[model samples]
Target: MQQKIIILDFGSQTTQLIGRRVRELDTFCEIMPYNKFPKDDPSVIGVILSGSPYSVHDKEAFKVDLSQFVGRIPVLGICYGAQFISYANGGKVEAADSREYGRANLEHFDAENPLFNGFVENSQVWMSHGDTITAIPEDYKCIASTANVKFAAYASTKQPVWAVQFHPEVFHSLQGTQLLKNFVVDICGSRQDWSADSFVETTVAELKAQLGDDKVILGLSGGVDSSVAAVLLNKAIGSNLTCIFVDHGMLRKNEFR
Candidate 1:
């Protein structure tokens, strides 16, 4: 079975964007609320906790039980997600004098960690959080730090967990995409086998097994998804599949010549 990434959403507005970034890397990724994640899945290659606008210091702040992931899959926590990991694992966080929002520099860093694998000191990163992590869990080692937060980035050798105090999935973070790619491709060790073609083949086989010798009609618009779906159906049911592409009188000049 191909390995997959599981992103535990903590209600971050940017959570879906995280999945988009992962998919952009040609790797299959899924997003589920922290509470709705599957219980047992050794095939789960990695977990990324998304940044939320909520503050972890509040009593009713969104929370996800990390007990199931403590020592298992490689985990990366962002912004609010980082605070959750820190506070849950015996670290300390306090409401900053003010929200630390906007661009900041990674004054100090460790290039060895996959998060900063290709980043240099003084790299710019996007930051937006009211609460800041001042300390980290006892088992975790601090890999990167900024002036404002002593524990900017940490890795737990004992738990395969890593957390960053920045929004690494955002385009403003200069090297944000690289950081994600390193974590997903390098640390998670995910295969680059995820693509439209792979999905088409898998779906075709599954459909054939489920509807053997059954006549089926598959219709699709010319959009990417519909096109792909139509191809899968055609592969599975062959001549039995019929596609309808209507030219709603909205074609570009010379489109149907």
Candidate 2:
């Protein structure tokens, strides 16, 4: 089975981008809603907590029990994820005197840290949070700081937990992808073996085993997913796979011609 990275989405608009970045590194990932987070599984090599619109101090803010995977698997929190981690671990996170958005430069960070590997001082990052972590727990050490936010990035001294107050999944962050690569590859030790070709090979083998002599019918919409599915099925069972394409009468001008 391919190792997987799980992302707990707290309703961030950019949460999907995190999964996209991880996939770009040839690593498999799945995004689950915070409330519907899955239990600890061996296939899961790491966990990422996505940002949210609600503040950690709010009564109705989304909550989850991090004890389930905090020490067992590598955890990387972003924005609200960072605040939630700090607030839950005897740290302090409060509203900033002024809202911080757009691009910001890192004032200082530990060059020796694994997350900051290959990252330069004063690297640009995207910030979109209103609350900042003012202090951290005894075991947590601030690793990166921006001019306005004190604890822009932090890691636990005793655990594999790390966090950042900026949106590293966004393009505005200079070393965003590299940071994710470090976590998923270097820190988490993911094999980074997931790819479209491997997916097709495994899927075809499974389909052949499941349907030895049975015939299958698939609907093709000329869209990416359905087209890919049809191809895989055809490769698996050859002539036993039949494809049906329906005309919805929504095609563009001269589409059928």
Candidate 3:
């Protein structure tokens, strides 16, 4: 079984970006829908809860039972993930006086905390949410804080669970990648064994097995993404792979086409 980090997507636009950022760390990860958690998978080493557009108090908010992950596996929550877990438990998450968004600097933080392992004094983080955590349960301790947001980051004293209001996966966060690295590499203790080379080698083998004597046509957008995908598919099944490209046509295409 291949070890991987499981990211529970709560319909956040930046959720895939988080997956990309984690993979950049040479660690394999999967983005599962919010409610569809892989409870019995021992291959999962960590879990990341992605942000969402809906509030925790919404009439139609998506939710999951955190009990399945909390003490069993390392957990990292971002934005709505942070709020929902807090609100669902005994903590208090309230509507911010104003929707806080964009760049913010950490005014106070515990430099000794595992998550803030290489963080400098003025670490900048990207925030995008209308709600904020006012208080956390007694078992959790504040690890990082911004001038406006007191609960910028928190961690469980008894377990490896942690939560942050910022989006470290975004580009604006200066040390955001470092934070992710700390959580993934330091806290979660991932071997850092997965990489693009390994991904290609493993994927090609899997594709070959799954598509035995089968023809496949993958859509291409003339972008590096699909182009590389075409290469991988071609490697997997030889001439059995075919692709369709867009016309009118962005040579530097966006995947959303």
On TM-score, the leading prediction is 3
Q: What digit string (tens of lDDT, one per residue) describes model 3 on residues 220-242?
A: 77767788989999999998887
Instruction: Assess each prediction's global lDDT (C-alpha) against the native.
Output: 0.83, 0.91, 0.90
For each candidate in turn, give its C-alpha RMSD to the true structure in angstroms: 5.1, 3.4, 3.2
TM-score of each: 0.80, 0.83, 0.88
Better of 1 and 2 by lDDT: 2
Worst 10 residues of 1 by lDDT: 217-226
Ranking by TM-score: 3, 2, 1
Give the least accurate 10-residue stretch of model 2, judged by summed lDDT.
248-257
C-alpha lDDT of residue 152 in model 3: 96
| Model 2, span 27-55: residue lDDT tens | 98999988766674789999999999999
> Residue 30, candidate 1: how far off, in angstroms?
0.6
On lDDT, the candidate that comes out on top is 2
**lDDT (tens digit, per residue) of candidate 1 on 1-257:** 86788998888888999999998898988898878767687678888998877788777678888877767778899888888998998989888899888898888988877678889778888888888888888978998877777777888868778889988888888988988999999988988789857866788889999989988765554656667777778878898777777565766776545
Query: Candidate 1 has which clashing residue pairs, if any?
Result: none
- TM-score of candidate 3 against the unseen true structure: 0.88
Candidate 3: regions farther than 4 A off: 216-230, 241-257
Q: Candidate 1 local accuracy as lDDT?
A: 0.83
